[model samples]
Target: MEPTVASRPDPTGLNRRALLQGGIFAGLGALVATAPFFADSPAAAAAAPGGPEPSAARLKLTKFKDPLRIPPVLRPRGQGGHDELTVRLRTADVTLHSELPPVTMWTYEGVYPGPTIETVSGRPLRVAWENHLTGNIPVTAVDFSLATGPSPDPLSNYPGTDGCQEVPGVAGLPPWAAVHLHGMLTGGGNDGWMENLIGPGDVQLSAYPNKQAATTLWYHDHTHHVSRYSVYAGLAGLFISRNAEERALNLPKGEHEVPLILSDRNFGLDASGALTGRSVHKVEMVGAQRLMRPHHGPYTLVNGVVWPYLEVEPRWYRFRIANTANSRIYRLMLLADGRPVPGAFQVIGSDQGLIDKPVAVDGALNLSPGERAEVLVNFGAFRGQALKLVNTFQGVTPGASNQRNDLAEPDVMQFRVADRKPVTRFALPPVISPTFKRVTPEDLPHDHPHRWVVLVGPGSANLPELWEMEEIDPAGITFPSAGIVQVQDAQGAVKTLRRTAMSYDEGRAFTAAHDGVETWKYLNLAAAPHPMHIHLAHFQVLSRENYDVTGFDRVTRGSARPIAFKAASVLEAHELGEKDVIRVGTAGQIVPGPNGTPGELVTVAVRFPVVGRGVHHCHMLEHEQHMMRPLVVSPAAHLHRGGAGGHH
Candidate 1:
């Protein structure tokens, strides 16, 4: 059978009495002892391959009872030429909701979602990220035994086999962290290398040149193996870069602007069946492999508050939204008086910066992990009426029935339009970014560099792997394994390719010439969708095409064949803007066969203006820790063969 996407528990189907009788919610120890019971249950059998889905009983929490929190903007101590500040990663007890007790979390600057740091374009900023966290991870569900080990049977209760050992410097050591500024262009040394970890009392100083355009960026923990846990524990913050051009547009400013940092989380239950308030990291078995699925919780946090409500004046407001979830993809839509409100907001910017013109959001706006969007919403017409920000995303579990789970919480937040007069009246300009230019294939130099990166999966332990591919002549090539694929180019010419580096430590597989543009084609051959993120540069999505995957046999042969390319019109209008992350692979589709499934090919055009080493991988924190690769950028004259391009 083929590997399936991880399935979430049906919140309504959870038997509270049965769980109590089985000692599942008795305590953390009892929960572990009762793992086999759930593994054999129908719920476990239906489990898929994404992230962990805990019981609704454990994730119980009230929604929309508390006011939303707008993180305070950090004030730089220095000004003019360069700005500097200090951010500390420490543990604190935070009140996530009004009814629930304070939850202990590892935070940046002692708060969840941290404090927002603002900067100016062309200016420079420096930060000292201090690691003040001490003790084991805050999440109760962290299983270090599964960190580095062979696959374990779902029916067994043993933590692992005799060969199962913990990852050194992570399992038993004090908490460590490495911070990465997502969507920021900087050198690798300052880009937060995964393995360059810092322990308690240690600080990792980073400098940002701020040469790029004003955009929405965020910083989070990037430690090699523990990033998933650290980020879930709340070590994340917003970094906004501003420019004169954006200011001249007269967009909403000061009190009219808000930052919406979205995240989802599940709370644990204690022996008394009371909410523990601490976050939980649950794992499950998929086939013969023990997998740590991406976490999706019952509670939706907007700016660190669960299902919060934000009061909006009767005026146009700018909302900078960032999806900081560990895995969940939010399909957001605004509703007034319980009816869909189309064209209620206009998207002005994407991951990198403002697009050429504002794209009116006709319906729902899809935001995957690590992606950001800036929009302008006018609440003038809805004065005295309440609006709801809801998620219409129904997750997909390949090879399973496609149905919306009623128990899934769709309500994200409530927007209460106060019956107040507008502070000022202003109209949106026709063009928000006059300097913005669209990038096209024709603009590239002749014979521009190109690289094929494929997302492969279910390799050893049912986990996905990223492959840096190189094409070879098909004259004498024979199908040997599943990693090999045959792709048809634009002219209908077929080419054979195979996987190169499969892990982060394998070696650097991609190299780009400084000041030159390269087209990177990402082919996803996995059952789940991957939001691929590239560091040190922003890229434009050229196109997305669907390919046939029914021929590829994972057990016996490699038989992937590219079908006639079809444009994916589902790409949103705002997506045309430059981005640092792009979603690829099978999105929301049930697997048609047991051995193979359809795939998606996403092509992007990236220009390497900064020369240094950097990494790229799925923004899904779990996938990134396991399936990431490194790349280097240097001058064209110094580029040599036998690296990423040598295979051809």
Candidate 2:
């Protein structure tokens, strides 16, 4: 088959809305118009023609027949000594809809979610990530323009292609692979540097020290410029780092504890149950270039099954919930037969691990992409009730509504309460891990460095600048795409923050001292809130402050009228634990286009536990592809501390 490319439209008399409506390409437009991709699927049939139509009623009312598939737990290879494992990246076919044919997917070990890797803290392991993928991308619909790039690095040495030119599939790029253990503090070589791409037949070996607290970490593809598509094709999984302290808590285990990997997927299938070679791509007219913005699917998948149901005994159950969606934000709540169940949810842990105590969730649990919430629900009271986990946030498109407040995309999964057994072993203590220590500003050393992280928006008048930060090879890399924002200090000095200039320039942006506490003030300048993700170590949120956005622009210009600042609410219960991902601002509340949320600021205290190099980027995979930059921990700054957050 010949490679397909979208023909750019003439911009003479076009407006952004007109372009979004129909300017991608005559072929793509025809396919979208004629395709009833989700019409046959019950979960997505109620969505509007253009996009997801938020429907609380539809979610609360619909009942699914397929039971939820729980991902199998993958334990370490060896019991005691150094463990060695091999994770193969390859292609497989998965069934999303019961009636539809299996959709061809790129996955780790051929499973939709790969497998849940369970390990212990202090038990280190090594993995040889092998890439065994080749041939054309199976999906028919793609914005191939965004996937291609210049020459790839020799380190990413794929078998046969020259990096200098475009290849086939999405973005005319070959399938390159890199594995990132999202929240692990391993060596610089193991942190899944975005520039380190491995292609077909290549093997990349990395180590995990497992030195951090017992928390839920994840692994996924981080290949330069292709992370969004790669992960979308299913190269992601959960890694549970446990320890004696956590095991002693005696929480639900063996069929009682579950890992709920949540995500939104837009899939099209042909009659043969294969993913229709086409995808749901949304285009935007930015400046003179038309860019394909991130796509949000109408269907929600739990453990890779669409709108599935799970049988649960009428007792307390522990759920480790992770939202892996590319862009969807979930305001998760539980409903019974179309009505909201009040005070039914309790959170025992945040991203890093078990909190000092359990906090009752008064309303829905709000989780963004890459955020995790460990929740407990007691069905002891309603043994026979049918409850549905639902999402109410309706920002399917950025800065836009779901049309008429219609609940078009809220259904998650269903839970049918089963008969209670004679004995109930587990119980929720009013306080959990009571001795859990909380970090205070006074605990920070006097000489700790205070850093500034600013999240910016797309650049004005530069459409090509919106694509992924180029790969490392000088022959393939582009210096400046779009500058997300400028990082500044109290003295009014500014540094433009963009992708790394060179692949190997580890200290391009900033470096952290080992074992030193750094106060990171994240100024959210983008219109949408970004889930700022820091690798290597988890951090504590200090405080959030809102500024007079309009006045701040002038303040930066030397019009010193003292920009008014407002301290927001105190840290909530769920946010008090160690965290690696936090939404820096209120999503969808800021102005649209290349403007930053000059008024919002989120401050966090981060301590680099291990000496390594990693990249800190927005967790929204689409944004990260275009904006992530390198962060390094110098070996010279190594200091022996008690442990990361005193876990030792």
Candidate 3:
């Protein structure tokens, strides 16, 4: 049966017109004052826990019935020192699965997952991102008022009409777009600032220097407040940077190399309980508050195909895997005949570039949202066998009672190895990148800057907050002081800190001197894990420690001194590589100190080579729209004659 839109009553007692008119959750201030943290709101009382379930039409769809789609490579107009290209953002009707009908989506160049743009390192590539979108945005179930009430930041005002004046005639507002090249080292003007939005008929020209090492980077919509909706409507693509250093390795090329872009979506149902063929933004009730949580559906998409399968030759292949999901964290593993494949994944690189050496991963590889991994898999051993790539990570909605596994997909995709003889065997290199060097504290200058960052949540209406921390003297600190937290320093001495900046508009609290190295400590105080991403810089994980989250008094905004300062195990081989995004405060078990705490404190070292203004925030698109802040890198001060100060 073909999926069609039904004229059924809205399940959450909120219709499309009402949602666009900003009727639902309009009285957010009143709801936050009277509602409990986990209680159901009147509007969503009839909704099931963990939001709505997939419709009957969607549930009947089979898994791995369709072939995987490889996004076409985008051709550049010119070559040599510089290249120019134009990418159009427009609406298209795409058939996501064979079982479902064609759904209208806002895509880049009229294709889902867009097209892959490959470039040579050190070359300058200029792209004109043109917006040609028409009509209302494809996503309808979004909560535009979630971050509305009583926020000083202008970005917090969702569906704000001020920014929509350019594009008229659409319900609520026309689609706005700001293309961001994730993990690229570029100037602040071309970095896709969140508020640099362009409506229909507008164009945004960006130039990427591509001076960083060869690696995998992606481009996605980054409009403030509406990014989650735009990206979900299909506006993302991969940009690969290659150089002679990486090509000399001869790892995998041509048909042997593949790009796997992973994403998830949930379809809306009509009045007849049939699929509407439209992506739905899920909403959950947490005690008198209707909160629109991150969308996680039963359908899993790989390169725009739902539960797709790939036919691989009986040889070694390179896979560049990227998790583009808004909020899902995939613990990916390879299995054959329902059993684990030992050393299936030989990871060679991370987000930024190649690691020092390839690490064989016999277990699962944890990939958080916005994270990417370059893995090499050998299919020669399993020539006639079919392998399955699965996600073992079970996701849980924050504050939702329904811990239903059905809502989260376990099966990602399938790999059917062809039954054929090997053409030519390639030996795996021990040292993938001979030039790669690990960053250590000894290499940094003495008195390098150290910054503190904290992730806290449920501040107002269950919203998550990212805070810039300032250290204070513990001499006269009182216990249970409001907005103050006590933690153990690296020397096992007690240190008091206070939250400084919580909003995006807050003046830049983090500053670094050009060519200077800095260390940052991220403390996760919230229940859920946050993939903290720093812009325009690649960092190395210095250390990780466990903390006592239960000791944090949310009411008093204070925390106990005992953060259980103990050294964690050595960093994972894949983690040794440079990364732009780091998962903080995961639920995984770590080495605990005297007190078996449940929080995480991660420390990382970064060297700022680019002088510009950029923003850092959680990679989860929903959280990023609300929890983001600015960072600035300034020119180093001139040294005096015979002065002790010098560039690191």
Candidate 4:
């Protein structure tokens, strides 16, 4: 029998108590452990008609199963931004080494590493994200709240939680996550707010208004605590937003335009394709073998093929590249004439969207997970020549809080130039689209009404007498969910984070629309630099505020503190108009906070979708679901459509 979406936990088998301790731990532990393995792992190796190695067996990894075989481009689903775009997620089993049994996976239409979503920028789009699972986050009934007391996390449990979370549609899995357009102006309320999770039988609304930045934006699971697990467990993919204006640039269109989704994964050759991981500190890993994909792996897959190959025409091609790997960073380089293709890709856009001008790279291109780039490559110059796409992110030395860049040898795929058929276009446009303006600190437009929100991390709670715990909880979980983490290298500076089930900020809900204009600040107390993001809307970097004040006193003495902005280097960051994601720098370069982390970042104005609903959370899916999800949107025409909880 197939696994039902929402089956009651073996009611006849066991009552409540036992399910809580065993099922919850087993389910969460499995989710957390299996995540990193699927980053770029592909489904079973189909025959490579025109490809590289038979399989990337050298690198055994996990990856999202490709979504149902849907065409890349699709029509808008909702009248406004909440339309439904159909995406089918399924799973299959794969054979492997040893006498291990086959591992089962919840796949995308039966294939790993789901499909790419191609659409236009500025135009509203909806995605009907469907979850068809053989198994899921166990459906056991378990309470996920912090044992007690108010969570000091930046996020508030009740704020963004509309009402949707009550129903558990999928198996007992934590509400994994929904789609969040990485770098585009989208709606706030339905922006994949972490709390608005969906299940097998249930559905959640992901609505957003497009600011028309006309750039490359992507979609991935943004669950707070489970982000590292979900994305790693094969729940990530691509999104392309285009605009009429961008079309006029004479860039590659239709077939010539390609979206190269990059990712990695590690899977056990046995057990129906279930993943296995050895965390740095999971109490279980002390004896188990849950390794990070980077630390291991011999082969690489491009578009779901180990050392895969592709056929390209000798003409100017627009490649929308997305690095969907959970932990690996890929420094992409085209190997032309044996050696690396020197300065091949001229990057035109990044995570948020288009860069003001195109920037060319020599030898290699570095891409971190969740990062994307749009480039123009003239295949005409290298027609008939075989190009090997190589991974170069694995250069960093192992051991540390930082992720791995050791994907260099993880050669993704190959591109062969068939004889160039005569075509009108010979070269790519020197420039893609007209430049977008950047909002500066001085004289910015005001949003409808603004409330100061602080991006706080659970600090002080993690502080201990020894100054540094040789072994600390990774995120404060037990057993398979190792909670021990390495402390930041601040030396003797006291650092403490409240004991948390998850490491992300607690979400706080906010309702009220900023009629198309408003400035907001994102203050961060977490030690790490989080790539902060919001759906349905693009925001400007108004200024960065760093205050040395702490506690209630900081807000009280706020008038004395000032905010400032630095010249952003990331070309795409200068959005003359609105955008999706913004890099909120840490405290001090622009401002300081007495809490030792970033205090606040003044943001540019934004416009909610016509219906007004979207999500605002950390771009890092792992952090968002755990505790970083929030619901902030404009006044809605169909407010009651979603309810106090949410659409799901």
Best-fitting candidate, measured by TM-score?
A: 1
**Displacement of the residue 111 alpha carbon in candidate 1, Å:** 0.8
**Model 3: lDDT of residue 329:** 75
lDDT of 4: 0.44
Model 4 agreement with the true structure over 47-119: per-residue lDDT tens digits? 2113333332233332212210111232343354444455655444422211223334444433344445556
User: Worst 10-residue stretch by lDDT in candidate 1?
Assistant: 28-37
Clashes of each: 11, 24, 6, 140
Ranked by lDDT from best down, the candidates are: 3, 1, 2, 4
- lDDT scores in order: 0.70, 0.61, 0.71, 0.44
Q: Tens digit of lDDT per residue, candidate 1, span 546-572?
A: 766555566643554543344464567
Ranking by TM-score: 1, 3, 2, 4
Q: Tell me how candidate 2 scores on lDDT.
A: 0.61
Number of the candidate with higher TM-score, 2 or 4: 2
Tens digit of lDDT per residue, candidate 2, span 240-307? 88888888888877667877899766544346444442333322222234443444565677877767
TM-score of 2: 0.74
